[model samples]
Target: MSHVRVAIPKKGFERFEKYNPENLKSFEQLIEEQNGDTYCLKLNMHLLRMYNAYPQLVNLKITRLILLKALSKLPYQHFNFARKYLIWSQLIDDGIRVIIDMADLLENEDYEEFWMHYKQKATILPILDGFDEAIRKYICFKVGSTRTTVPCMEFKMKLAVDKEVLMKYITQLGWMINGNEVKVFPLMLNDSNDRDVIRGIICSDIR
Candidate 1:
């Protein structure tokens, strides 16, 4: 795996692989990966609260593993180049495809497989784009029609929660553009790694 060259911060991954998940620092890095800039997408804190509140979704760590994927369509406007962990989906399926896929991946605490899947820089964007479309379609047909005040009303109702409490948190992180204009276009390539922010300080001797 060392020679495989994962896109993650090498030193931080070393700690993650070595230290206990219960160890505060290792746990913090995991938390960072969930909500931090390592990946362009982030978890919806509100959806996470919902997942936590439901016993069926409890104890699976599904919130941590799947919530970010649920919100993968969001944009990340940072400039770090070494690690292009942009998670976008282009697929057109409803939600079933991704939900089943995510469930299979997390079924047995398959962290290594998940890590390997995410370390790729090439496919994250397309996968996210696909997942985004899937979510919209699934929420519409299987859950509710887009004509409703809330598109995914049926899906939310399945959770047995009030629409008010199921407050959404996705639009907060999307691209912002007024009049579809751009004021600046900075052009420069950076070879530096975003590992420090993502995985914390890197150690010269990770061994």
Candidate 2:
């Protein structure tokens, strides 16, 4: 009599055990060395596959690291790299897709919409340490470099922060809060070309 071989799928917890400390250490090393490298793109995809299959098995620390790296490249990469990686991995759902959507809004300078979306995804905040701060810094830099002064109300809306919280960032930036306006920089009553030059100078200071 011929017998047919049957395969049994491993239990979820059993699969989870396979991602031991040793494996995690090795994975972290690879991520550290290949950050921003093209080869790392494939490595990220592999991670996404595991996350999609058994999110409970994959560590949130690892997920946060990869997602933050992707976010850091925004506006510059325009999230094309992130989109491609997610598409190839077929894991563009849930928090992952939400982050990419946020990146899109930031790239387009749609601050109000981005904040609204961010609030809706507050549940994902635990895995996104420093995300709001990073975005706020980016927006502050953009606004500071481009404009000498911005209305406090408008600035607060752009940052999605209350007046008190906005004051903290303004103080840290060495900007003055005058009446209803935040002075981002000294008034440069110059032509557009001169303003562009001043903007370049201000941007260089951050770099």
Candidate 3:
């Protein structure tokens, strides 16, 4: 079954939050605000684990070196920077992957290598926009396809898979993957005027 999904803006909200302290009343207030913001959700798993294992360590260090290496291979090199930050800060590696994938799709023009990664599930769907029209055409052309890599958003076309096949692959590295029953709220990235914001929801599982 498709699982529940939610998308938030690639709003660079975190960067703004980090740099724009004056936007809020106090630094503590800023932190509290982001706790509910989608951009800051990646801290949940580590935060939860910290309370149990070592409450003394306010900052957890993950040192996910392998994941960091993977991030460097993406089209947009900025992901390598983001990935390094996550590893250094002990944030989820999958979150790093998702961010890199999304950034590559949004900023980079190359897709051939990117497609190869998605084919292997080494990368998740990136935050992309500007291909809704192409998506419609791909859906019409491909049938019974497990996944399709198109110019727009990347999609996994699971037409007749049962719950058993579904269960095995439901877990996403950064976000949670659900079955056909999953409901995703679209985050609109494109408008007639401004450049399309990066589309795609941030799956809670991944965050």
Candidate 4:
């Protein structure tokens, strides 16, 4: 898997902690080390909190991944061009069909075939505008039609507990935000073999 660095806001951290405390820092510290000027974009602490609290609905990581993949092969200066043309173009096309709408078209047996094909292609996680919708529908189908446990909801509930505990821990640990906004910057992961380092860094809390 190609790893891309992402910067999340303080509020986003709070939300992540609120949702699932277990290994919560596993992803948080990864975002913190990023230079704020490059990646934070226009997001604020308030919006970060809101997005984190209900990530299944408001998250845009898929889009982020898509843009990153297309630009990763280009020079850094070309990112703006890629974002304007390739990313937005792909987003428009994907959004129109919408994954939720397409989910109804597949039979139970078709999912396995589709899953296998996508996984083999390594395109299973590609950028799809309605990815959340598609994932929800697929999970529902996978667990059998009669099952009522919503995976998204279950995730949120677990996340909420974790988030709450993380917040308390961070506060006690003095990892509070100092302002309304923070700048974010990009950090390149030069090698693919450093999974252990990546995992360790993310799992650590910022002091």
Local accuracy by lDDT, each model = 0.32, 0.61, 0.32, 0.34
TM-score, cand. 4:
0.21
Q: After superposition, how far is residue 127 of candidate 2 from its true place, in Å?
A: 1.5
Predicted candidate 1 versus true structure: per-residue lDDT over 154-206, tens digit per residue: 33343233544333321221212233221212223232443344233223222
lDDT for each residue of candidate 3 in 10-90, tens digit (9 for 90 to 100)? 443353333232322232222233311222323322232332343333232222222322232222232343343343334
The per-residue C-alpha lDDT of model 2 at residue 124 equals 67
Least accurate 10 contiguous residues by lDDT in model 4: 180-189
Model 2: residues >4 Å from true position, as ranges? 1-25, 28-65, 72-80, 88-91, 124-126, 186-207
Measured against the true structure, the TM-scores of the candidates, in listed sequence, are: 0.21, 0.56, 0.22, 0.21
Candidate 1, poorest ten consecutive residues by summed lDDT: 74-83
**Which structure among the candidates has the greatest TM-score?**
2
Point out where model 1 deviates above 4 Å: 1-10, 15-21, 24-58, 62-67, 70-98, 101-207
* C-alpha lDDT of residue 148 in model 1: 23
Q: Which ten residues in a row have the lowest lDDT in candidate 3?
A: 193-202
- Candidate 2 per-residue lDDT, tens place, 20-114, comes to 43344455555545433332433444454445545455654455457656575433342354354343233434666677677778878899999
Candidates by lDDT, descending order: 2, 4, 3, 1
Error (Å) of candidate 3 at residue 158 is 20
**Model with the higher TM-score, candidate 3 or 4:** 3
